[model samples]
Structures are given as structure tokens and as C-alpha cells.
Target: MPEYITLTIDGARIRVIEGTSVLDAALDHGICIPHLCHMRGVPDIGVCRLCLVEVVENGRSKITTSCTLGAKEGMVIRAHTEKILKLRRNVAELLVAEAPNSRAIQDIAVRCGVTEVRYPFHHANCVLCGRCVRVCSEVWQSKVLGFVGRGKDRHVALPFNERPEYCKRCWSCIDVCPMTITPCDGPMKEGEEYLCGKCASQLTMIENSPDSCVWCRLGEGFQCSRWRP
Candidate 1:
């Protein structure tokens, strides 16, 4: 016999299979919870802490990670409360501050209503979400890349911190890594089009340089980087 459980997310009642996480349940209902480290058909570690939600029990509300919290019978969930929004904003701001070069983080900051960061920007390259590490070890089964150090020194590194001879040459790690994306806010007129992150940053390299279609990261993905016809 199959088991199902009924739960309420933001006042919308839904029934889902037992053991389904609240994040998946909400997503199944077209409710998007802000998240960074979630990938479908892959294991969720709940390390991003972006999909935080409130679960109400006995008239008391508590914050929990939705990707790990399973939906149970009569569970009441609030995905976007004021407190949750504030927390999410803070998280988004911090992420943006660390990797302001990532268009993904910038867009997420906008979505989370984060305009500025209070903390000092570290200008780091990797947010250390471990998406690439897990993908390589789990889906690709290559284990070519793994964490190199502990705490602040920790980072994704190739086996022995050097390229392996048995490497499959598949760039799946780059494709799965969120930091690899350099999205451009686009569809600009004439010269403004095709201003990808790499292309846009070129302005700092050379003064009074005209913007052109560098066909950067977004273009490589075949994403929209051209003007509307």
C-alpha cells in the first residue's frame, strides 16, 4: 500500500507521498523556495541553507531547512514569512558579497530583495556549496575532484591537487558548477547587447572601450544575449 500525507504550504493544501521533503512538495505545487545547492535527481545536502521555511506546531513557529524536512500529515508550512525573507536576504547578501562576479548570485540577490551587503566583501571565487564535488563523485563517479583542506583553507581541488591521467576529459563538473555561470542582463540596444560577465568586466581592463558581442558565457550556453529582432 502506498502512503500519502497532507500538508499546507503558505495556506495551499497539498498531498504528497510520504517522506517527501517540504522543498520538493512546495516545488511540485509551483511554489519556488529560494535555494542554491538543490539539484533535481541528485542528493540534497541542505548545506546552502537558502530554502529555509517555517513550520508551525502547536501554535509555535520554528525555522527549518525545507529540503531536509519531510512533509507529514497535517504539517503547516510557511515558506515566505517576514522572518524567513529577512534571513534569506541576509544569506543572499553574504553570498553576493563573497562572489559578486557570479551572475547567479547577483540574480539571487535581486530575488531575495538584497540590495547591499553589510559584511566586508572577501571577493572569493568559490562559495564552497560542494555541488561540483558531489556531482563528480556521485553522478560521474569519477571522484576526480575533492576538498583539499579544512575550514577556511578548504576548496575543491583535483586529485592530489593535480590533474589526473585517468581523467575522462568530460567537463560535467564545469557544467554543474554554479560559479561557472556568468549571466548577463541583456537585450540591450546596439552596443549594449552581449555584455556577459566576462565581457562587462573588460571595461575595467581598458578605458573608453566600446562594448561588442564577445559571445561570452551566456552565449556559449545559447542563452539570450542578443537584441530582440
Candidate 2:
């Protein structure tokens, strides 16, 4: 077992294992922290920034991402302070303008009480949470999807904006995406040489290699035949 550390969240004292994120601690203690693009089994990209919390240390409050930041002893975390709430509302508004068609974005905006967007809508319809990129790189281990352009054009896609021939027809990228920018087209028919089910064209390169089962890898220190059976 790992060492557990005590921390204060919104003035509530709690103990959690070391390396545990503040968001995880909050969830464990029945504290609600608003977030998006954060799945339990996925990597913490922290691109949404909706889980920002105010941490008071040495008599000062600062905003930080709870998903990426681990809890430490004597740290005071304020999850739903006025300042943090206002920031969250503003961030929600920005996301709404970008993805006006997304119900998830609209629902989050409503929850944050953001009725209108004050900032100029310069960003595209994408929130750029990088969930697609993270799923492709971390979970699938395929370097296919990436940020092609810079600044406002910094959207996730294949290299050189051209599809690769090494794709393996895995839809992991589409399955784990937070934003619904990528549509789910049906699988290819029998006549097609390589059939792409869902967004398999976007993340098929990962299946090029034979990977072992994740559970067996951690359970017995090697690939277990039980998973195959």
C-alpha cells in the first residue's frame, strides 16, 4: 500500500493516497467537482480546465486544475468559490460558442448559468480538449492524430492533413472523444478493400502491432492466457 496524505478541500479535511489528484479526492469524499473531457480510465489531458479550483496556501488563493494537480499535506482547496465559479462560467461560455451544436457543451453552459457569450468567437467549433489526441497517443499508442497547425488552427488531425494507409480500422479515437465533431459513419461494405467502422480511419494505425491485455499485464506481470480464453 502507498502512503496516504491529509489535505483540506473547501475547509473539509480528507486523507487520500499519495499521487491521487485533488479531483479524485473530492469525488471520493462526496465532493462534487464540475469537469468535462475527464474519463476515469483515460489520461488527464487537463485541456477542458473546467475543474479549476482555488487553492489557499500561506493566505493566498490561486486557481489550479484539480485533475492534474495532486493533493498535498496542509493544502487548502476551495472548489466552488465565487471567483472559481465565475471563471468556470466564462470558460463554459467560450466552449458553447465554439461547439454550438454540441448538447454536452450546451448542457454544461446551462449548468454554469451562462446564457450568453461575451467574448468574440474566434475559436472553432472544437473545444480542443485533446481527448482525441490523448486517446490516440496514450490509449491506442498511435501517433496518427496530432496538432497540425498553430494557434487558432491548432486542431487535432492526421499528419500533413492526409490519411495514412497503415490505418487498422480501430474506432478507439471516436469512442473516447468528448466533443462530437467526428461523426459515426457505418462500417464499409464487402466490396471495400479496407473497411472503416466509425472513425477507424483516424486511429487504425495503433492496431498495427499486437498488444497484450491491460489487465493481464498488471495482474501477473505478463500476458495472461485467461483473457484470450
Give the best candidate by TM-score: 1
Candidate 1 lDDT tens digits, 158-216: 97668897667787778766677655653223322221334434333322311122222
- Residue pairs whose backbone atoms clash in candidate 1: none
Q: In model 1, how large is the Cα lDDT of residue 168?
A: 78
Poorest stretch of ten by lDDT in candidate 2: 216-225
Candidate 2 per-residue lDDT over residues 81-196, each given as its tens digit:
77887999888887766655444555455545565666554324467777677777777777788877888767778877786765445877665554543212322223321211
**Least lDDT summed over 10 consecutive residues: which range in candidate 1?**
209-218
User: Model-by-model lDDT, in order?
Assistant: 0.69, 0.62
Model 2, runs deviating above 4 Å: 120-123, 165-168, 181-229
RMSD of each: 10.2, 13.3
User: How many pairs collide in each candidate, listed in order?
Assistant: 0, 2
Please give each candidate's TM-score: 0.77, 0.71
